[model samples]
Each structure stands twice: as C-alpha cells, then as structure tokens.
Target: MWEVMSDPQSSLALPVTRLTRRKTLDQVTAECQSHDLKRTLTATQLTLLGVGATIGAGIYVMTGEAAADYAGPAVLVSFVIAALACLFTAFSYGELSSTLPVAGSAYSYAYVSIGEGAAWTVGWLLLLEYGISCAAVASGLSGYATSLLSDLGVHVPAALSQSTFQTVLSGANLTLTVGPRLDFVGGLAVMIVTALLVRGVQESARVNAVIVVIKVGVLFVFVGFGLQAMHAAYWHPFIPQSEGGFRYGLPGVFRAASIIFFAYVGFEAVSTAAAEARNPRRDVPIGIVLSLVICTAVYILVASVLIGIVPYRELGVADPLAIAVNAMHEPWLALLIKVGATVGLCSVLLGLLYGQTRIFFSMSRDGLIPAAFSRVHPTLRTPWIGTILLGILVAIATATMPLEVISDLVSIGTACAFGIVNFTVIWQRNTRPGITRPFSVPLGGITIGGFWIGIAPALGIAFCVIMTLPLCIDLLRALGNGNPLPAILLGIYIVIGIATYFAYGRSHSRMAQAPFDAD
Candidate 1:
C-alpha cells in the first residue's frame, strides 16, 4: 500500500510513493529460499558465529577502559545492567528471525513490520553499528598486536601503530586533532579479515570457531592466575566517590553500561545470517539467544577477575588485559593473553564485516541502494564488491579514528538499531497476528488501548531507551562543555541518510514500482 503525500507544498513532503510499504511474510521467506547465498551454516556454527563476534573486544579490550574511566570495579554492575537490557532485545530478535528468517537483521525486520523508510533508516544505522564496530575492534587488536610484537623483540614504530588522530582536551573542550601517526597495523588487519570473508561464509565460520575456543581458553588462564594476585583492597570502594560529573559514582556505572554496551553488539549478527542458515527458523533463534547467554556469563566472570587483580585506575590503557597479566608477574601468561586477543579480535572483525556486507546486499536487492552491492560472486556466493568497498572504508576509519571516540558511537548506533528491533516485534504482533512464528518471545504480553504488546519487546524498548539516554546525555553534556565532534558526526550521518533516501532510495525502491503484496 502506498502512502500518498498529504501536504504537497510542505518542505518535507515526499513524492506520492510507497514510503511506508512493507514486505509480506511470504515474500520475505520466498526470497530467503531462493537467494543466491549458500545455506551451509548449522545451529552450532551460528552460535559460534555469535560467540566469535561478541567475546573478543568486550572482554579482552574494552573491560579495563570501562572500569578505569567509568565504573571502576563496579563495571561488573555495568555488565549486568547491559546484559539484562540486551537479553530483552535478544529475545525479540529470536522471535523475528524465526518468523521472517531473512538477511539484513534489524533492517529486514523493519522492512517487514514497519515500512521501507524505517528499513532504510535502520540499515543506515547498522552501517554505523557494524562498520564503526569493525574499526573499534581493529583498534583494540592493534594495541594487543603491538604489545605482542614488542614482547617478541620486534618493535613497531609509533607512527605505524597509533591512530592518525587523537581527541584532545583544551580547558574543558574535547576535540579531535590529526596526527602523523597512522595505525597501519589496524588498517592492515581489516583488509586481511575482508579477504577471509570474501573467501566465503563457511570458511570464515570455521576460522572464527577455532579462534573463539583459543580466546576463551586464554581468558580462563587469566582468571586462574589473576585470582592468586587479587588485592582485596581493589574492591574497597567498588563504587568510587564522585569526582565531578559521571567520572566515578552510581551515575558512572550507568554511563559505563552505555559505553560497554558495545560489548553486546555481536549478538545480533546472528540474525543477519538468517539467509545463510541451514534451518533459519530453528537455528537462528537458538543462535541469537544462546550466544548472548554464554557471552554474558563469560563477561561477568572475566570482568570480576580483572578488577580484583588490578586497581581500577590502572586499567585505562589500551592493553588492559595485558596490564593485568603483567601485574601477575607471569611473562608467559601475558604473552598468551596478547596472542589470544589478537586472534580473537580477528574473528570479531570477520563477523562484523560479514554482517555489514549482508545488510547492504539485502537493501541493494530491494533496489533501495545500488545493484552492485547485491551482485554475488558466481562461484564464492559472497557479495565481493560490497565486501571490498566496506572493508576499505572500515580500514580507513580504523587508521584515522581513536578507540574511545568510535566505541561510544558504535554503542549509540547499536542501541538505536536494537530499539527498532524490539519495536518490530510489537508492531508485527499487532498488525499481523496470524503470521507463523516458529519461535516466540518467552514472556507473554498484555493488550493496552486495543493494541497487544509483548512483555519482552516492551521491556526491550524501555531498556534501549534507558541505555541510550545516558550516552546521549553524555554526548550533549560534552557538547555543552566543549566537545562537539561526536555530536556533529552523528548529525551529519543522519542528514546524509535523509538526503540519500530522497535522492535515490525512494525512487529506486522496488516497493514503489512492484504490485503491493498485501496481507
């Protein structure tokens, strides 16, 4: 059904087109069956894919930074809050993926439940989420790689190992300034992962699974040794007294959750694999929820041990885990930690890069973007052109952007995307009550004002709003204080999405031209 522009003279008027057009469930499922992508992924592989993507940067890289800067030892509380929020959304994802079973993840769900315009918006945000996340993970990987190389008597120059730009504080104002250093290691890492992804999903998944095991084991070793070195005094003031604004206190804990929420970004990547799963209805849901459950448990355990071993203030470095291991006075374990972090973050890059390409592939297939993105390699069945294009852009970002800057942006983008994912469940439950749902959100819902809202999805939406509030508050506070770069970047991205839709997507959308596949 087309939505006609009611006010033709309005500044924001769209052409009389199907901006709110949605795809039928049948149509989505039919495309899933007929897509050119190979369907070789099993339940176990999909779960590992989620684990591979999720377990790396959060535990190995970001935990220490979050502890030192935001929550101190209470970062464990931050993890619990973030995990609870994500669990609600994860349930929503399981429901939608089982019902629709398509590529594009939240973007695809939005297309089916909400409209094309919303889908475009979600897809664009996903680009921010997955693409920025790749750069963030790569940055963390570079830090660990540099530490490992230095241990092996190989020193990488600061120029090649560090970011090209740094965030500077001048009397209260935070601004990003360019530097001569160029994170060559991080950029090169992205290109290597991109090449592996282009080889095919099965090959990538196999590699990711092996690395997942290695990293998990390495983390376990850290916990074993870390406990021996635990300083009970480190947990004395678990909730540090407030220094000023959100630096160390209860407020800081929530703020920490907002930042570390980036840790859970990989859980949704499983939904993006719907088109590639051998039994999407059965396997995708299992993958989405199971991966999150396992990862959350691991996050809490590792974080508990990490903070117990080191003073929170000392964890602000890029290689926080390495710092913890070094304090253990075990050079061998420290070396092992660095190696595991390097191998582990590579899988994160692979999973996120894969997700970004698949989202573009789905959008392109719908004629909402360029057709080249949808074009698959004849033999490999991967979106080669799109993969390469996104990879180069991610590499450039990794080379230029700092970890702290990009990680916050990724969390914000990911939270917004997840909110929409939760809402899709509520919208579809009401609008298409008869649709077949192979898996449903565990908790039942209630009817209000004649609209049915699932318990899990409603909570998911609320948690997302809660998760986003602090990050946005922090962003605005920074702007008011002096830092405007992150806010400006987010504004520019939203504007670009709006412009791109009117200039190309609206006209090119298949829904605008094809007969309405009405319910």
Candidate 2:
C-alpha cells in the first residue's frame, strides 16, 4: 500500500510518497477538459450567487445573538473584524482561482501547491464546512418559515417544527433535553434547494439572483426605517462593559467576530464554480472580491441600524431583522422581512449545495473518493448523484442537530480551510515563480531581505488563525460543560477521513500512477 511504502533514500520516519506527491497544473486542466461542465455563469450572476449565499440566515439570526450575548452593540465591530479576515483570504483565493481555475476551490489549489495528503485533509474539512453549513442555514430557514406561516394564521405543530434537541432556560440555569420531535421544515428546505441545484447551474443562478434582489431590497428598507426609528441613547456606550470574562467587552467583540464569521462562508463558494464560469479567470476573482465588499458594507449598515433600533440586549432572537421591524410597530414591514429571510435562506442552501457537489466532483475526479460522486448528469451537466446524496445527509443533519452546534463546526472548518489556502498561495509564490498568473496578489514588491513578502496572504493566514482560536476555546468549553457530543462527532469525522484517504485514496489517486511533469 502507498501508505506503508518507505523511501530508501531518506531516513525520515514519515512516508515520502505521501509528502512529495503533487498533481501538476497540466494534469488538473486536462482532467477538467475530460469532464467539462457547462459554462453558463457570468460575472454578474456569479456575484449575485455569492451574495445570495452569504447574506442569509447568519445576518438575520447571528446579529441578534452576537449583540445580546457577546459584543453588545459592538457586534458591528465584530462584523468589521470578520470582514477584514475574509478580505485578506479573498485576495489569496482570487489569485489561486485565476491560477488553477478548477472546481475544487481550495482543495484543487492544495493538490497542485501542496500534496495529496494535505488536499485530502482540506477536502475532508470542506465537506464538514459546506455540509454542516447547509444544515445550519436550513435550521435557520425553519425559524423564518415558521414565523411567516404563523403571521398568516397557519400554525406548525411544535413536534414537527423543532429539532430533536430542545433547550430550556430557567433563570440562570440552562438545560438541554432530547425530544422525539424533528425539524421537518428544515429538512424540507434542504430537499427543495437540492432539487433546484440538480436541475442546472444557470437556472440556479437566475433563481438566486432574484432572491438576492428581494433580500437586499428588504435590508435596505429595514435600514431606512431603522435609521428613522433610531434611539441615540443606544449608541452611548458602543462597546458595553463586560459583565463577566468574555461577554460584552473587547474579548467579547473578538469572540463574536469568530462566531459571525460564518456569514462570509459562502463567498468562497464562488471559486468552486470556476468549472462552470463563463470566464473563470476574470469572473471568479470579480465575483469573489466584489461579493465580499458588497456583503460587508451591507452587514455593517444592517448591524448598526438593528442595534440602533433596539437595545443590544433585546436584539437576540432567531430573526433579528424581523424583531427590529416589529419594534418599530410596522406590521406590514415585519411581514416583508419574514418573507425576505425565507427567500434569503433558501438561496443560501442552494449556493451551499452547489459548492458541496462541485467539491465532491473534483475530489472524485482525482480518485480521492468514489468515482460515482464525479458522475455528471447526461443532460444537466451537473453532479446529480453527489448533490442528491449530500442533500439527503444535510436533511438528516438538519432534522436532528441544533443550529448552534452546526454553526460552530462550520466556522471552525472554514477557518481551517482559509488558513490552508493562504499558506498554499505563499508556498506557490515561492516554488512556482515562473507560472503565469492571470491575477497576482498586489504589493508583492515589499520584501523582507531576500524573501518577497505577500502582505495580503500573510495577513490572511494570521487572521484565519486568530479567528479559529476562539472557536477552539468554545469547543473546549463545550466539552468541559459535559456537552461532548459535537466534539466527539467531529473527531469521528476526522478519523473516517484519514482512514479513507489511506485505505482508498492513496492507491487510487491519478497523480500517483502518472509520471510527474514539471510543467
């Protein structure tokens, strides 16, 4: 087996085959040609797809939670911090996507720049990131859907609407109980989005573009009304003093930044569509950077207005935007906000499902997993099988897991992927100096001695690492609090991933059987 093979030339403890093997750019491009997808997505549609994916349930839900629980009104600062981290990573992604122009996003970049082992790790992490994230967004969609239906005098049964785990709070004590209920609404949302994705990418993009418009328009309406109803007194102490250690102080702001960082998770999904992009090089970069900038601006404005309209303490709810709308006593606008959140979260699930399928497609093509995952629809030119399978898994997760648990796993996984991508750019710049890059990280002339420093990617790596620390602390805290199921689940996922790679992927990798070509 490849995992057991030893290098006779080296005395190192680890296997050289695992560390030294890399897929060349030529092979990746050739593989893409062999299994080509329809290129129907333009820069504009791609940007909207990104916006649709990103400006979803997180902004609607996490804003209130972050403000009420962690940063107070200073959640605005947290958004800025998270946006900065995403911005740094966006530049690195822009460069790599233009350079590789493959379907796997960071995973493809890792295969070419790093090695198969690292690529497998990244691919595994992305599965966790996109899969859990879709489930998380679906769970949020359930809340918005229930709220909207309730306003129309349609009541969903509590047993059918809620997740298996129920949280009960009595004064200072918090308790979680396992129940027989299922989040049927959330599961239904995932299935609906999966059907849209399996149809075609162009159709999905068009639907997403329309949803993006409605959602953005709704937010603008909230901002306009919220500014009118602003309470100046709420802005007095922007960063509220901490009642305890990491709650509502400077530390709380950083922690909230890590939490709300999930809002920007969908931007990188743009790169995963490179294989389907009309012009991968130009469109992917534009879609990524443009979407990040636009979403960050919108998030800042919405957070400010939301906090201004209601005290930060009162803003924590499943639907913060709706809460703010109702606080103004505008019933009509509140209804619109609820409808907008449902549409927004629908698009989020679609975008995530799209990205997840493409990642599996790319990994399967490289013989990292089952080739069945790479199977494209004869007419739709989509990874139908993977899409359906992933959708089913996400539906199951949504039906069972709590939203907060899934959200935290997504944040941690995405942060890890971003950190690896940053390092990939840095490594590629040093090793493949002669490779023609359609887009390059700017300000590379600034050097420390002989090494040309990439300020953007360097900061990207630092920020990603910084953002991940809090999530790690939160995970440890969860375990300490006797809630070890999530951590144990994540450990099991890693073990399965590692075992699969060594057992199947190592022997089946295309790069291993083919001769290494420098070009």
After superposition on all C-alphas, the RMSD of every candidate to the true structure, in Å, is: 2.2, 2.6
- 419: Cα error in model 1, Å: 0.8
Provide the global lDDT of candidate 1 against the true structure. Answer: 0.87
lDDT of 1 by residue, 1-519 (tens): 334345546435444235567887777878887789999999999999999889988887678888998899999999989998999999999999988888888999998888887899899999888888788889888988987899899999999988988888788677778879999999999999999989999999999999999989998888888888988999979899988778989988988888789889898899999999999999999998999999999999988988888899999876788788888899899789889999999989888989999999999999989998888999999899989988999999899887567567777888888999999899898988987889999889999999998999889888888789888888888789877878888888889999999899988988876665434
State candidate 2's TM-score. 0.94
CA-lDDT, candidates in order? 0.87, 0.86
Backbone clashes in each candidate structure, one number apiece?
A: 0, 0
- Against the true structure, whose TM-score is highest? 1
The deviation in Å at residue 444 for candidate 2 is 2.0
Across 1-519, the per-residue lDDT of candidate 2 in tens digits comes to 333345554456345555457888788778767775899999999899889889987789888999999998889889989998999899999999988888999998998988887888899899877887888888889988997899999999978888998666555334568988999999999998889998999999999999999999999988988899999898768899988756889989999999889889999899999999989999999999999999999999999999888888887777777778888999999999999899899989888888989999999998888888889899998888888888999999898877565577778889999999988988888778888889887657355666666888888888998798888887787778777766876788789988898889987987776764322
Candidate 2, pairs of clashing residues: none
Residue runs of model 1 more than 4 Å from their true location after superposition: 1-17, 517-519
